[model samples]
Target: MKKENLIFGIYPVIEALKSETDLDKVYIQKGIENPKIDSIVKQIESLNITINFVPIEKLDRLTRSNHQGIVAITSPIAFHSLETIVEEVLASNTLPLFLVLDQISDVRNFGAILRTAECTGVHAVIVQKKGGAPVSGDTVKASAGAIFNIPICKVDHIKDAIFYLQGSGIRTIAATEKTKNSIYTTNLNQGIAIIMGSEGKGVSNSVLNLVDEKAALPLLGEINSLNVSVASGVFLYETVRQRTQ
Candidate 1:
């Protein structure tokens, strides 16, 4: 059964897989144990498609009809290659700005961030393929159609993308509260890739250690943190302001 981008039921998903369907991710209910499920899992693994094991209730909420503990979410927008986007941008003679998302699981935040990235003239938005939020219909709606306007790259690892951007002469900056230096004092006019982590944990320690610089948003109001999307806008527009000023 197809509902928007979702293709549910066991046979339907198997058919989708056989048809070389472009699925964003497939969700299988956890701890069911079946031969067909094992076969489907192996097939999905062989194709390198993202698969998630979720609770039965999740599959229930995803669709009211019989799902057989399987559902596939398809992406509305085609993803671009990071190397291609970087190469095209470098050849253009424009200051490059890229947004790298680490473990951003919320579709709304992802969409809002994409909107902000597009508005700020970011060259491309990079996200880890498996761990990040799936580009579902909600994500497209949340992005306010900006997902279609901007180039998005899905990478295997966020660190490798950071390394490539760094090799390309673009500074990798992680937005984290761990650093005392704020965004206002940091240089943003240069080619840079800003890494925004999840809302709850901020940037990972491993990622924080690898960045060229770590900058924080000043928190004088005692909130300690800002929503990832809001923080992204502030950082992006700061770069915009610096460039315009």
Candidate 2:
């Protein structure tokens, strides 16, 4: 077993833990009771394998092969520190513009938003380590390959990111329908970070509270909301317009 490879079944996972292969994470079937399994769990805990107790059906679905009521998914991407990315941007000569997505799960929307962010000269796109969609091939294609060029940093918390950006002299703006202030009225000429939430649910409460300004797109039609990606483009390009002015 290798650190990069996935090892299924309780025994294999236990053996991997005993050996040199670092266990990234483990998924065990919830409500399972077995003495051998208990011993395996102790070893996994000692090795610091991030354990997730999931339904038995999930383990079955992931593999037709015998999973022994447990599975482990190998780590895909090495996480980049939010502080490091922001520092790198601030250390550079140019002003910074960042896009922070809160629980944005749709790959298409993520891709389109990234495309817009990159085109609008945003320095980086930050997202939570979990819940958000991965930078998959489809996302890259949807972004028209902008994913390769634009820097993306995964953080533990969105609020922390907002605070960090503000400390670095970057304003945090939230795009929400709940706000009456129009995006047009907000000054995006300064270094700033725009936070956009998912399609159904807007910005998380934690992030909403941290935004320096909560702005909305002026909508005259009956529709209550615009597509998240479309709305993001409006907000991002607005910054471009203000900067160009």
Candidate 3:
């Protein structure tokens, strides 16, 4: 974490939130209570940003300067509103192609996925505010600057995004070996959102239960799975293959 990426002190964070700055998360020293902080917390909740109640020692490690019991990490890219993206994509002639990430913790993996998503013309990416990698400089590098070319949305949970997409008439599918359905066998020519899970856990059972469909890439190798990024690319191109035909 670089010093330039951090915003410390009370009023700075309040202004950042009010101005709709791209913030990854906020760390507040536990036991510090103030009315302004209460307002900040409310704003954070409204924006669906993550809030961490860390100790002063944690805040110290983040910055040598006074953090005033609160420090916020700025995101390298601004986030799009999920509703706005959905409405724009739905109203357009372009197909509503979205990628929903379920806890992709590796910044490198997340960036590579974004690269593939951009290359394949994904409308937008829906990611959870927490439990995922922050959009750091490394992420921007791995994305090959594709991060700027794509719109990303941060939500409180991925499942709710799936519901919104489904309600808007977009099909939601999960890429997991837990299902017998093959990606090639499944239809991807229509409006769809593909959910790629974490590198370790494929997809949470809760999210898996709500998705409209579950798909798996047929692997013949001894290893049962592929790296999440490679798998994401394969899934993305397959959709491209389907739609182009």
Candidate 4:
């Protein structure tokens, strides 16, 4: 986290939101309430921005200057629009492959997934505006600068993105342990978008229902699931193998 990337004070944060600045998250002093703060909360909710309520001590630790009980962290990189990226990909004659992440908050996991996505030639990595990990310095380092190379889109809802992708004739596949279908058995040589979920909750039921198919990697060990990043790599490489073979 860099000080240059943070914007504090209620009015400044509100203005940033109003201007449609790309923000990863917002922090407010817990239990503090005022008309301006109320308005900020409303704006954040309407914009679907992630926010946290923390102690004044935490805010002081974050910055020495007067934060006025509010702070906003800007993303290190700009986000692309899903529709715009999809249109560009569809215009190309080659089959399009995309990765959609649902609520993957761990910066390290997010970065590793991006690395794999770039290596495997994924067209774009889509994440939700609220629950996805911030494109912070840590994520950039973890991706080994691959974040700068790949297109990333932040959508308001994962379900809406799924529906839009399907409507465009791209097959959407979800990786989950709950499904009996295996990725090895699924066809990945066509235009597709693969959905990977959070570490704790996997994909949401609503999103799982919308995908064209659900597949899982067989786990030989006792562990029931793989790390989100590792599983994503497996899914991506499988796509590569099928397309190349």
Q: Top TM-score: which candidate number? A: 4
Task: List, in order, the clash count of every candidate structure.
Answer: 0, 0, 0, 0
Cα displacement (angstroms), candidate 4, residue 9, comes to 4.3
Model 2 clash pairs?
Answer: none
- lDDT for 140 in candidate 4 is 88
Give the Å error, residue 57, model 1.
18
Error of 4 at 231 (Å): 0.3
Write the number of the candidate with greater lDDT, choosing between 2 and 4. 4
Candidate 4 lDDT by residue in tens digits, 125-177: 99987766777767889999999999999887999999999999999999998
TM-score for all models, in order of appearance = 0.80, 0.71, 0.78, 0.82
Residues 1-245, candidate 1: write the lDDT tens digits.
Answer: 35788999888888887875667788999998888988999987765567899999999999987999888887688889999999999999999999999989888999999999999999999998676777766778999999999999988899899989999999999999998998999999999999999878888888888899999999989678999999999999999999999
RMSD of 2: 6.3
- Candidate 3: how many backbone clashes? 0
Write the residue-wise lDDT of candidate 3 on 56-87 in tens digits. 99999999888889999998777899999999
- The Cα local distance difference test for each model comes to 0.89, 0.81, 0.90, 0.90
Off by over 4 Å in 2: 1-79
